[model samples]
Target: MTFHVELDEPRCVASGQCAVVAPDVFDQRDDDGVAVILDESPADDLLDDVREAVAICPAAALRLVEG
Candidate 1:
């Protein structure tokens, strides 16, 4: 299984929740502070943190599509 992680930059509030929850998968851009996808398809072990990041995103800017 693979997960597709996407970030809606316009909706991001730069809260950095995703980064905190899953640093290996999510990060903030140096200039805008918007959330960026470091790893679109992370390993299974990181799935939990990725899901938590998606859930805890304050602006609902993060999404997870599993396939």
Candidate 2:
């Protein structure tokens, strides 16, 4: 299965919690401090952290797309 993640800018608050949980899969733009999905399909072991990031998103901007 392939997993995907995305951040809707209007809902994003630039908390950077996703990066804290899974740096390899998430990053923030230096110019605007916006969340970016670096890698949607991270390793299975990192799935937990990705899910945690989704759960912890303050603005509820994070979304998961399953394939």
- Which structure among the candidates has the greatest TM-score? 1
In candidate 2, what are the lDDT values of residues 1-67, reduced to their tens digit? Answer: 6787877878889999998998989999899888998886777777788889999999999987767
Q: Which ten residues in a row have the lowest lDDT in candidate 2?
A: 39-48
What C-alpha lDDT values do all the predictions have? Answer: 0.92, 0.86
User: Could you give me the TM-score of model 2 versus the true structure?
Assistant: 0.85
On the 0 to 100 scale, the lDDT of residue 41 in model 2 is 72
Q: Which portions of model 2 show Cα errors greater than 4 Å?
A: none
Candidate 1 global Cα RMSD: 0.9
How far off is model 2, as Cα RMSD? 1.3
